[model samples]
Target: MERLINIDNGGTLTDICVWDGEEFSFTKTLTTPFDLSQCLFDGMAKASTDIFGEEDLPRLLHSTRHIRYSTTQGTNALVERKGPQIGVLTDSPTLAEELRTGDASAELFDDLVGSRVAVIDADRDLEELSQDIVRQVNRLTTDGAARLVIAMADREKERTVKGVLLRKFPRHLLGSVPILFTWEFTPDAVRGRRVWSGIINSFLHPTMERFLYNAEHRLRDHKVKNPLLIYRNDGASSRVAKSVALKTYSSGPRGGLEGTKALSSAYGLEHVLMIDVGGTTTDVGSVKNSTISTDRRGSIRGVPVSFAMSNVHSSGVGGSSVIALRNGVITVGPESVGAAPGPACFGFGGKQATITDVNLLLGVLDPDTYLDGGFSLDAQRSRAVITEVIAGPLGISLEEALIRMEAAYFERMSTSFADDVVDAETTTVAAFGGAGPMSACGAARIAGVRRVLVPRMAAVFSAFGIGFSDIAQTYEANIAGLSANEFAATKTRLRERATRDMFQEGHEIGECRLEWSVVQEDAEGQLLSEDSYSESDPQPSASAHHAMLTLTARFELPHASIPQAEATEKSPAVSSSTRNVRSTAAQVDEVPVFDLDTQKAGAAGAGPAIVEGPYFTARVPQGWKFDVTVAGDLMLTDTIEN
Candidate 1:
């Protein structure tokens, strides 16, 4: 494999993993939310500096084969409702009503569409309907509609509306909004799903389009040979232009699952669970029998959307999540003070009490060495916030407040694994991300999980995972019948389209491994049967409820294998130091601090001990034992016999 760079952008930090062909190394940088491209380049500069002992972005980009990117920005935007105002134009009242059904849909609808929805009559005179559309478009836009979605079932009506909108609102017009038709995304017969696909894609489009294209153009200017490949939720990659926005949602977490799945296979783990704790949320997913769980009809933030999404659940609790007393009972987050003013300990004028402050105040994290000593954490700022927001209001001492805050924070994360991690007793928890290792043991124990694994590159594992993905393009067409003529025509069309897309990606049809799959979905959208046929095989018969037939063209890319750590027939490296940490308000103990980088094969130690990775930290509780795997990853097992 040529030199590869995989980037995972989180709300608090951006992780960069570089494969210099000889070895894999990673780095972390603070996220610049105002302009995501800034951090993208900054991380590259840092990686280049690490590789060459000085910053040289041009040389790094020129030598790179592919730069695959994934981010939690879409996930965070949806969670915070921090996207553009979208207006829906639907002629079907049933679909309109269905779009806003129940509490979850209702809440999302109010944010995405609200009163900006314009219901039109299909039977109205062409002139009158066009006039009404113009007025509605103007009204919706006048009332804060940044984008518009058309969700009409009839294709002809949709075309007519499209014609009317384009004529009335030209693309070149200064105030005209980009209009998306539901059919453009999918050919689903399900009314609400089609609309949701459009709504979500439209909602996530602007931010992704703006930042991704900006970064891609900047890379091009730097003489980078390849266009940016977006690591998607479905474990395939496409260039930014060819990628769909909704698929980018939760893509970061999906990358984590990929990394976890790879390590699970290496470790021979049967059932495994991944907890990727970033700044804004704790993304949890399960891997079983070498397969990463995914949903055909994916849910984003508990609201279903028409997409193939990896079954990763994101909770709004993390290291940067606010920890507060509501009615004297602790409550976790739905709101986060992201990178701009990260945690109070970051000392960027943030006053909110978070788990970062709690951990720092308790000395579980060393202020001086945090983030590879990127910057010093402010103990005073952390203490002030914890004392004011938690201790004073609850009438508790500083140490007691820290203890309570940390417990509440860990509990919130542990609860997320209730149903997410199946067979916790047998499952090995893969803990990663900036904050994942810190609470892995405590959270896993609470969730009844006894085994834990932390990658040596745990801090940047998601980016590392992106290296596992291959370039793939999938095309689907709703087949009208099983007649050979109809099937042939559809296959021809899909092949032609795929050929064009792959050509744009600088790959030819000959280079890609293609296969055809047929699926039959009933009236209720449940699958009846499915089968696959190769290019050489005869076409397989579809079931009576045949709905959509999909064709996948995959270009197999080279992947990096896990490195083998040389065995050492020696005792674990002794702790270079010890520090006093408060296990409780009244209890303080000096525990050994073992740096994973210095640990040897078969290195083993028991907690309460602090295990520090390059950019992350793990606090091994008293009952757990930390063992260094031959692969150099840390494995924390509960010695308490759960």
Candidate 2:
């Protein structure tokens, strides 16, 4: 039996889904930040006991074919500022000053300004600066720097510092140190974005490393030999033991985008708007021709990153948010009850009217019988409160307030979704998350989107993405100054490094390919539309390039060195007022021996089929086709013949 474990964490709820070859099992538990993995264990235990009998539970769980995790830890780290302080090393004071503010290095260093300190590398002798380096390290260590980042002036020498730095600081004092070299962090030629990437890695790597270490240990106790995979914002996964564990932060939402890509490609939907409404927020992204669009700087907790990914926008709208009227206007939420207070509808002491309460009032949600009866909801109490608290205050009838609130919620969701899918003309909305379906059709309507694709086990789709993700790693080597041929060589080297890293994680690769694109734009002040490259290429189309240009131009950009006209052929032309363009490439490789089956069971279960384990069900719609496949992905489509 192919048993797979998938975990999804929402604001108020943590959902677990298991695929046991023959059937699917699911459970829901409160999200515990202190020990998020506890819920995973609890969910796994319940599935084991229910499916294999209490005595056989141990053996069956130990035999789990795959285990995947989707966490919000990195998001929380930035939002709550729980990460340790990071130390940055710059090429020189002038270059360091360029990154002092409005850059990722600033965010990573948290801009303490002359506090932890930055070492200026003025192309001078290292022997002369050994003592100064030690002093800085000691000062930073005392000031709470748990990690160090070295961004060099030449960038290519980013990896060369290990030999140079160890000689000065010695391995004992900084030997066990978590050092992030800019070359290794982002070897791509663009120095500015490279700095941003390094900063992000340096800032968040420590927290993620510790969190995953604890999580993997807990998983090991369960006798599961399968390693935990960290998901990247670029919609890929790598083993937890890899040097780039910081990529784990992007896993939770990236999985959803991956699922969207898989679904749209299989179903032949070329353009799609994926709305992942979770407990704390609603994330929106667009897929064109099954490709996820991403911004140059990945957005994590409102911070722009150097990495690229599907462009996603996160809003405070979620199932657990307190719903009320402020300034006589119905406000859905930016504040959540989280796991502790939960929602009033959960019978958990939450008095504020939440979106869940509104769902209960509208008859779309049955509080008395929700989640297959694992938790009973009191509709009458919610109705009473909705009437007394919201309707009366607004001087409107119960039905009117309920209608207004629901309309407002959908409107907010739709407007935000519009911004993401603006470039996609023919797009379908794939809805997931706890309350995704309840408002999906309506939200789509308001957003001017036609067709809503609700996958099987929609609420747990993120978990499914986790289960099927590939073990992958990405590296950027800045060859900004390298020629086209040299750039290709750099790409080859990056692929080799990625493969070696994956092999170290016990993965074997059968086939690997590198994807490279040249980025061209005029000088910093020039508009991309005025550039020759932008007028020539058709892939990104004019609108997409325009958007990209608008975004990139906002920041002070560096000149990209590449052969003229080569960029026009290799990459989608982007407009820039500045004639200067940079050459950059990204390489992705898949590890061998991991199996993924994207097929399904022969038939859809009847009556919100309860597969096993916890109280999770697939509420298949009338005339919908459902199945579980080799990839452990649940597929549901409207099969009523055309």
Candidate 3:
């Protein structure tokens, strides 16, 4: 059987999903942030053992037709400020002026500068600017900046600066530091966003380069001939060497969005809200009319950039989120214990109380069956931490504190839903991620969502989503004149460039699918209107004129074939055991606990039940009933309403 492997390297866990023609196998291992490739191989090895009954790395790599990877490392590095120090060089004095006056743009500038970086102002004159660039490069490098970004406000100045820098410091030189040009990274009309994008990419370059290159070398060592495909925030995959670091921000959440789109289409749902609760964050996204929503000017950690990506809103509530009592109120995390120590239940020296610990305390998670018994939970350790940190501080019993903490966790999750997905005409809530199933019911109830669907592979759903992605490249060009002819000519040019680039990447022209769109902007460059056009459509008329036009061309290559499991009829539900789980209505009740794998399609059960899987546990509250679809999806609905 042909094999396809996909992996999502998250902040805490590195999840692997493998498709061996007829069946799917999924597993998770701890992420080694110091060397992500370690976890990548470890997870792959575990999946290999499950598939082939042996942990032979080279054989698995050689047999695999494709290996797709996604990671949260870029976002994590930016959030933690762990990347290399960078310096910015601009032709205008406005950056310095803004820094002095503390303008809105200056806030973003400050975010880029951080503590170890510096900014240098240069004059527009070619000669003077060239000298200034040299002086600043020397000064910044002396100050320990390993990377430099050039972001001139004026297009001519930017061109001159890039030319001067390249001529002065050729990349082949032994002492040459890596230099990046803002326009090369992004030519968006928004100067600040373009500059920030360049800076962010520069900061993430070294780490991404190291990890991705190391992974590729490891693949080579294992006799894997296919290029390592990296996931992008635009819901596509690209060769690792061709991918931009900035385009990978929020890529893990983007994979979830892609999977949600597929599920939405297969289940015939008009609108779906997807919530992915991982170890460190809960990402929420919406899909309408079978299309994932996208934002062209998406922001990372509140700093806007011009890269188009899936519109996913992330909150700091997850399974491993640190839970504590702050100022007489229960608080769930924006901070996480992550996988190193994990939750108190992991017994890896973690002392903090987390949502995972609360689930253990409430008897929702089966200690003996967690991770298919690969790892066992330390209930005593969980109890000790919760008793001291949460229960004692709140002057409540363990169960009461557990219930309150759960309420707080779900409240924060529900607020994110209300903020990002409530008004979107959502018909179903698709929950995935290691912690997603555990929190889905309560989050859905609080958000007034009536239907919830948890796929059989809910825990490794993002990695599963990566299995559906295509290899794609996007190109953009700014139209100089706002004429119909200009728009058409620009589109032609960009399409040609895109086709050429993809061809160089080894994709044939016939195998590529091209999509086109135009962005219209006013004199001030504020967005006026954006529309998609086809090759057969007439040129946009001059009467619908705009100050500037930006054209985008997307080239898509087909993805590998993924087997779709057929849905079967519902069967009578059976339980392996009973556990007392705290209901959303604030009552502890003994609920039937069903194993996800053992329960066949057509199996049906009611709320106030626990559905345990290898990686996640779904808590069905009092008012709900869950049925197993033939496709192996657990469909949970409000019993009274449905």
Candidate 4:
């Protein structure tokens, strides 16, 4: 059988999904921060064992047609301030002056400039500045900055400075530091953002390069003929050598959004809200009219970078979020325990009370069946931590404390959705991730969402999405003051570059799909419109000076055809047993629980029911009804009160 393997490495777990042309199987393993490849191989081996009843690594690797990988390592590294120290050199003295004058650009620059870095002024004559550049470079190196970035406001000056630096300090020489030119990556007018983008990419490059190359080498050694593809933040996959560090940021979350888009199209849902509740954070994104929303100017931890990526907003609300009472105010978290010392219940030396502990205390999670019985959870430890940490401080009973913690956690998520997501009432919530289904009902109720769709492979949904992605690349060019002819020429140039790159990656031009679009901005740099570029469009008048024009070219690589779900008769949905589930409606009742794998396609049920799958558990509250679709997706709808 033909096989496809896709994996998503998150903060706490690495999920692997395998498609063998006829059936899908998934497994998870704890993330090994020291060496990510260990978890990658472990998850793959575990899933292969489950599917084929053997643990043969070489056979699995050689037989797989495509293996795609995504991760949140870059995002975690950036948020934790665990990257290389960087020094910046810019020509504009206005950056410092603008800071005093409270300019927004300066504010952005301040956020991007981390500790252990210095910004030196290079806006002087070449002869004079050359000496100063060497001095500043030496100073930064002495201060422990291993990387340098040069960003001049004027593109010409930036290029000149880069050339002078390279001539003075040739990379071939020993002890020469690497330098990045801001304009080389993005030639936009916002010098601050451009500089920040280069800095972030430089910070992430070394680690990403090391791990990806190591994984690729291992794959080749295992006799895998095809190159390993890395998932991008743009919702596509590209060969490792052709991808930049910036494109890998938040890639795991983007995978979830991509999966939601596919599900929306398959179910004919026009509007959907995706909530990915992972170990460290909850990422929320949206799909409108079957199109995933994208942010041309993406940000990492609120630091804007010039990259077109899916619009995903994240909050520190997840299963591993630490719960506490600080200053008599109950707080859920902006802090997480992460993979190591995950939660008090994990028994990995964690002492803090987290949402996982709260769930275990309230019986929302089945301790005996956690991780499909792969690992056992200590419910007693969870209760002890919750009582000592939360109940003791608030002087409340254990049950009340659990209820309060649940309310606080859900409230934070609901408020975040209200602030960032649009039209929640009309949108169907597609909940995924290891912890998403557990909280979907309460979150949906608070967000005023009427429907929820949990995919059969919801636990590894991002990995499933990666399986459906195509090998693609996107290129952008700045066209601020170009006429119609100039714009057309730029588009053609970018297309040629994209086509050549894809060919080098072993994809034929004839078999590839190509698309082009023009992104236009107004005087203030706000996005005005993005439309497909056409040769028949009217020429722009000379008097009409457009602020900026961005040309984008997308090349789609050939991929295996995904099989459609076949029609099958619905059988009676059988409940394994009943469990006492606490509801957000302030009630505790015995809820009928159904196993997703054994449940038939025609199975239908009402609210106050629990659908337990291998990796996730969904709680249907008292006012909702659920029906299993022909495609095996669980569809939940709110019931009207009479």
lDDT score at residue 594, model 3, on the 0-100 scale: 90
Q: Candidate 4 residues 1-642, lDDT tens each?
A: 658789999988899988887677889899999899889998988987887799887778878877889977777777765677776776665554432233543443454443434454556778887887777777777767777877777778888778777777777751645678888887655655676688889888877888999999888778788888889888778889988898899898888887888888777787988888888889989888779888867766666677777888898888898988999988977798888989999999889998889888777788888888779899998988988998988888888899999888878777656664466566898988888888787777777777888887788888887766777767776776777779778767776887788887677655666665566655434566676655355543322222333333334433323224455565557899999877643668787889988877778888778888878888787788887876677888888532
Q: Write the per-residue lDDT of candidate 3 for residues 578-620, one digit (tens) a residue.
A: 9877654367688888987887778998978999876888988
Once fitted onto the true fold, the runs of candidate 2 whose alpha carbons sit more than 4 angstroms away are: 20-23, 53-57, 94-97, 100-115, 119-121, 156-164, 174-177, 295-297, 380-389, 395-399, 421-425, 476-499, 509-642
Candidate 1, residue 345: Cα displacement in angstroms equals: 1.8
Residues 1-642 of candidate 2: C-alpha lDDT, one tens digit per residue: 657677776656777777775566666667777777777666667667667767355675677755667778777776667766767766566645565555644654454223555675535566645555666667767777777877777744554556667776666757556777876665344455566566666667777777778878876776667787665665555567764645666567777887777777666677878788887788887788878776655545544445665677788888777678788888888887777777777777777777677766654454534765667887776777778778999887777777777778888778758765654336777888776765665566566655566665667767766655555555544333455566456555755665677567565433433333334333231223323223123333223221221111010111111111111112211211111111111211121111112223232322122121112222233344334432333334443443
TM-score versus the correct structure, for each prediction: 0.94, 0.75, 0.91, 0.91
Better of 1 and 2 by TM-score: 1
Model 1 residue 275 distance off true place after TM-score fit, in angstroms:
0.5
Task: Output the TM-score of candidate 4.
Answer: 0.91
Please list the residue runs of candidate 1 whose C-alpha ends up more than 4 Å from where it truly belongs after superposition.
123-144, 163-175, 544-546, 563-570
Q: List the residue pairs that clash in candidate 3.
A: 567-630, 567-631, 568-630, 569-602, 570-602, 571-602, 571-603, 608-620, 608-621
- What's the lDDT of the predicted structure labeled candidate 4? 0.77
Score candidate 2 by lDDT. Answer: 0.60
Candidate 2 matches the true fold with a TM-score of 0.75
Q: Which parts of model 4 have CA positions greater than 4 angstroms off?
A: 96-126, 174-176, 420-425, 482-492, 534-572, 582-588, 640-642
Go through the candidates in order and give the C-alpha RMSD of each one to the true structure: 2.4, 14.4, 3.3, 3.3
